[model samples]
Target: MARILLRSGKSPFDPVSPQQVIQQNLIATNTGNLLFGDAVHKMLLTPGTEITPNRYQVDPADADRINDEYDVFVVPLANAFRPSFKRHLNDLSALIERLRIPVVVFGVGGQAGTDYGTDHLAPIEQEVRRFCSAVLERSPSIGVRGEFTEKYLNGLGYSEVDVIGCPSMFMHGRELRVDKRAASLEDTAGLAVNVSYDSGNIPGSVIGNGLINRLADAALERYSDLVYVAQELKDMELLYWGDVSEAAGTSSPAPLTRSHPLLREDRTRLFHDSSTWIDALRERDFAFGTRIHGNVAALLAGTPAVVLCHDSRTLELCRYFDIPHRLVADLADETDLAGLPAQLYEEADFSAMVDGHGERFDRLVSFMDRHGLDHVHKPGGDDGAAFESELETVDLHPGMSSWKGGHDGGLGYRLAWLREADTRSRVRQSASDKRVRELTSRVGSLERQIEESAVLAKELAKANKRLEQLVKEVRSSPYRRLRRFAGRLVRRVRSRS
Candidate 1:
C-alpha cells in the first residue's frame, strides 16, 4: 500500500471538541481551510493508498521521516500566494526541497483586488517562485485556483501550472447537482447567511458597501430559521465563549460581536469540522455569503448557494467552478436591502455549475495522475465509499452555538467543556505564575551581580589612579633625578673616548 501525507489541521473524521479545535487552531485560523482539506482527503482515499493528515506541519527536519514513511506529500491550499502567508509558504518550500518523495499542490491561489491585478502580489513573487520551483522539482505540475493565479504564475515563468479550481467542489467525484426548491426567496423555509467581517475595511469589498451585512440584517428580521454561519476563529470564540476579548483585535460592527442580534438570539453557529458544517447547510433552503467555502459547503450539501464576490480569490474560484455569484459592487446602487436576498435567490442559476462539474473534476483527476498520484475518482477506485463509511461511524460534534439559548444535551456538553477549559486555564496560569516568580528571583540575582561588578569596577579604577600617581611621584623624586644625571655623564665620557 502506498502511503500519502496530506497537509491538514485534522482529519475530517476526527471527532474533536470545539474548545480543542479553537485552542489548537485545528481549523487553521479559518474554518474554510477544512472544506478543501476534507475534500482532498476523501478524494485521495483510493484502494491500496493510505492517507494520514500531517497536522499542518512543514518542518524541514520532518522531511526524512516523511520520505521514509510516505510515498507522496499532498498540499491543498487557499490564497497561500499572498504576503501574509509567505512565511508558511517558504517553510513548506524548504521542507519540499529536502523531501525525496513527490509533492503535489492543489488549488493554491494568489489573492488580490477584485480587478484581478497582480501588482499586489509583487512582494511574494520570489517566495511564490521558490515554492513552485520546489514543487515542480518533485512533481510534473502545480495546480492553481483560477485564471488570475494561472496568469500570475505564467508571468513568473512557470509553464507547468494548471487551473484545477478547488477540490471542495469535486468532493462528490464529478457528479454535482443543485436544484432551486423555491421559486421566490419569500417562499423559502430556511436561509443560511455568511459574511466576512474584515472585508468591510477593504476598499471595494461587498461588506465595505454594507450589502452583505444589510442583507444579513434583513434575513435576521424576516426568517425565523435564519442561521448566520461564521468562519473566523474569533467569531467562533464569540459563539462559544459569549464574549471575545477586545484584545482579539476584531473591529467594530455589533453584528460581529457578541451583542449582535444573531449571536444574542442564538442564531449564530460555528462548525469545528466541515462535515457538520455541510450537514447543517444541507437542511437550509438557500445559502448566500461573502465566504466562498461557506457557500461551497451549501453547494456540497446540494443546497442552492450564491457567492457575494468581494475579492479576486472568491471571484476567480466562483468563475472557475461556475458557481452562482454576484459582485457586491454591482448591487451598490440598490436601496431595497430587505428584498435583495429574495431577488438574488430568484436570479441565481446553477445549471452551468452543475452540468460542467464533471469536466472540472476530470481536470483535477488528470492533474493528480500527471503528478503520479492516485485518487478515488479514477477508474476501479472505490469513489470514496470507504472514506464516507468511516466518516459516518465517527460521532462528530455539531455546530457550536451560544450557551445562553438552549437547554439540550449540547448545552450541557458545552458547559462541561467550559468548566474543563476554565480548570485548564487556571492550572496553566498557576504554572505561569510560578515561572514568573522564578524568573523574577533570577533577575534579582543578576541585578545583585551587576551591582557587585559595578563596585569592583569603581575600586579598580581608583586603584589604577593611585598607581599612576605613585609612579609619577617616584619618577619626579630627587633620587630618580640624580640617577638620570649619572647616566647622562657616563654616556658623554664614552662619546669623548
Candidate 2:
C-alpha cells in the first residue's frame, strides 16, 4: 500500500451538534475530511493533530511506521498552513524540511491573507513562503488551488506554483456546464453561507441579520427559498437560519448535514452518499454560496451556481475554473438577491468562461512544465526523468498508467489504500467525545453532592436548636437553689443515721 501524508484540519465524523457546529468548522461538506494525495498509490493517511501539528494528516508517531517502504510521501495544505493551525503548520513545515523522499501536492490551497504591496498577509506571507520553499525544495512544484494563491506565492518569490484549483472541483471533469432553466424561475434561490464559529469571526462567511434582511428584501422581488449550505459541519449557517426562521415563525427551515466528519470512509460510501446533496438541490432554480466546492457540486449536477467569495480560495477557484461568481463585498445596499439573477444563471457560456481561464490554466501548465511533470505518465520511460525522480517520493502518480485507466496496479491496489487509511477517525472522535462526557458527568456528580449537603445542614441546625434550649434552661432556672437543697437533705439523713 502507498503511504501518504494528508492534511485535514477538521475531522469529518465530528459530532454536528448545534452548539458544536457553532463552535467549530472542522467539516467542509464538499472537501469532506481529506486533502490532496489522491494520486498516491495505496494511499495511507498520516493525519496531523495539535500535539504534532506537522503531522496533522500523517501523525509523527506513524513516522517510522510510514517513513519507509512506501512509494512516496504526500504533503497537502489548506490555505498553505495559515495560522489557523499554527503549531501543526510548523510541524508539517519541519517534516517537509527533513523529508528524505519526493512528494507532489494536488490542488494545494495557498494563503494570501494580505497583499504583498502592504503588510496585509506579511507575517503569514513569511510562513507561506517558508512552506513553499520547503515544498519546492523537496517536491518539484506545489499545486495551488487558484490564481490568487499563485499571485500571493509569486509575490513572496515563489516561482513554481501550479493553479490546480480544488481536487473536489476537478472531481467531476475539466469543464463546467450551466444547466438550462425555464422563464421566471422564482422561489428557487439558494444561498450557501459559511457560518463557522470555530474560525475566528470570519466576516466573509457570515450572513447575519442585516445581511439576511437585505437578502429578504431581495427575495421579495423574485427569490423563494434561501438555502444555506455548510462548508464545514461546524458551520453555524444553519443555526443562523434557525434563529431567522424562529424569528420569522416560518414553518420550513434550511436543511442541515451535521453528520459529516473528518475521517476517511470507503470510497463507494464516501462519493455516493455525498451525492445526495445534488438530489436535495435538484428543484432549486439557482444557487450561490461561499463554499467553493458547494457551488462546484451544484455545477457538477448541471445546476447553475454563483459563488460568494469568502477568501482567496473562493476567488481563486472561480477565476481559475472560469465559473460564474461575484465577490461578496461587491454586493451593495442596493444589491438584492431577489432581483433578476445575473446572466450567469442562463446563457453565460461556460465554454467561454473556461476559455476565459486562459491565463489561469497557463499557470497549471507552467507548474507541470516547471516540475517536468505531465497530467499522465507511465513508468519505464528513460526520458521521463521528472516522473521517475518524483515517483520515488509518492507510491502512486500519473506515472503508474494502465490501459484500463488506473485498473491495474493503481486501482488494484485500492484495497491496500483502504486497509491503511481505514483509520477509524470517528471512533477516535467518539472516544474523545466520551471522555468529554465523562468529565462533564463528574461535574454533574459534584453538583449532586453539593445538593445533598442541604440535608446534613438541616440536621446540624436541629442539633444547634436543642443546644440553645438547654443553655437557656440552665441559665433561667434556680440551679444553685436546687443543688443547696439536695446537699442539706444528704447531710440531715447522715446525722439522723
Candidate 3:
C-alpha cells in the first residue's frame, strides 16, 4: 500500500477546541476540522492507499521523519498564494526541500481583487518562484486553482501548471447538484449568510468592506430567520469570547462586535467541522457571502449560493465552477438590496455549471494520475462510496455556543453546565500540561546547543594558547636574535657609506 501525506489547514484529529465543546454533551461534536482536511482525505483515498493528515505549519526537523514515512506529499491550499501567505509558502518550500518523495500541490492560487490584477502579487513573485521550483523538482506539474493562477504561473516562466479548481468541489465527485430550491427568496425564508471584515475591504478600494456590510445589514433586516457564519479565529474569538470587559477595548471586527445585529440578535454561528457546517447549510434557503468556503459549504449542502467576490481568490473559483457571483466593485454601485439575491440567481446558469462538472472532474483525475496518485473514483471502484461510509462513522462536534449548558434550557441545562465546568477544568489542565511539555522539549534542545557551544569555546581557547606559545618560542630563538643583529649591522654599513 502507498503511504500519502496530506498537508492542510487543520486535522481531523485535532483536540476539541473550546469553541467546539462549548457545552457538555454525550460526545464532543467537532466537524470544522473535517471541512478541508478530511474532505480532501476522503477524495484522495483509494483501495490501496493509506493516508495521514499533517498541519501546514510543519517543524523543519520533522521533514526527515516524514521522508521516511510517506511516499508522496500532497498539499491542498485554498487562497494560499496571497501576500499574507508568503511566509507560510516559504516555509512550505523549505519543508519541500527536505522531502525525498514527490510533492503534489492541489488548487493553489494567487490573489488580487475581483479585477484579477497582478499588482498585489508582485512582491511575492520570487517567493512563488521558489515554491514552484521546489515542487517541480519533486513532481511533473503544480495544480492551480483556475485560469488566473495558471496565467500567473505562466508569466513566471512556469509552464507545467494544471488548472484543477479545488478538491473540495469533488467531495461527491461529478454527482454535484446545486439547485435553487425556491424560485424566489422571501422574507420568511431561512437564510444562511456568511461575512468577513478582512477581505471585504482592501485599502484604496471603493468596493470592499462597505459592500459586504451593507449586504449583511440588508439581509438581517429582510429575513427574520437568518444565521451568520464566521470562519476566522478572530471572528470565533469575537463570537465566543467577546463578552469579557477586556474584549471591549480589543480589536474585534466591527461587524462581529456585541453591537452588531448578528451577534447581538443571537444569529451568529461558528462550526468546528465541515460536516456540521454543510449540514447546517443544507437546511437553509440560501447562502451569500464574501467567504468562498462559506458559500461552497452552502452549495455542497444543495442550496443556491451567491458569492460576493472582492478578490481574485474567490472570483477565480466561482468562475471556474460556474457559481453565481457579483464583483464587489459592481455590487457597490447598486442601491437596492431587496432583489439582489433573486437577481443573482437569474443571471447565473446552474444547469451549465452542473453540465460541465464531469469534464472538470476528469481534469482533476488526470492531474492526480499524472502525479501517480490513486483516487477513489477510478473505474470499477467503490472507493468513493467507502470513504463516505467511513466519514459517517466519525464522531460529530458539539454545536456552537458560549453558554456552559447546551443549547437546551432548564434543569437539564444546569446538569450539563455542571458537567461542562468539570470538562473545562480538565481541558485547561491538559492544555497547561501540554504547554509544559513543549517548553521542556525546547529547553532540552537549548541545553544541548549550549553544551555544544561550550565545547567549541574550550577548543578555541586551547588553540589560542598553542599560538601564543609558538610566538613566545620564536621571540626567544637563537635564529631570531641573529637575524636582528645582521639587520642592524647592514643598516650601520649603509649609513657609513
Which candidate would rank higher by TM-score, 1 or 2? Answer: 1
Model 1, position 92, has a per-residue lDDT of: 97
Q: Rank the candidates by lDDT, best first.
A: 1, 3, 2
lDDT tens per residue, model 3, 117-222? 7877788888899999999999999998899999989999999999998777777777889876767777888888777566633333444356677777777887
Best by lDDT: 1
Q: List the residue pairs that clash in candidate 3.
A: 29-396, 29-397, 29-398, 30-397, 31-272, 31-273, 31-274, 32-272, 32-273, 201-209
Best by TM-score: 1
Number of colliding residue pairs in each model: 0, 33, 10
**Residue 219 in candidate 1 has what lDDT?**
71
Using all chains and alpha carbons, the TM-scores for the candidates as numbered come to 0.80, 0.54, 0.76
Worst 10 residues of 2 by lDDT: 260-269
lDDT of 1 by residue, 88-156 (tens): 999999999999999999899888778887776787889999999999999988899999899989999
What is the TM-score (0 to 1) of candidate 3?
0.76
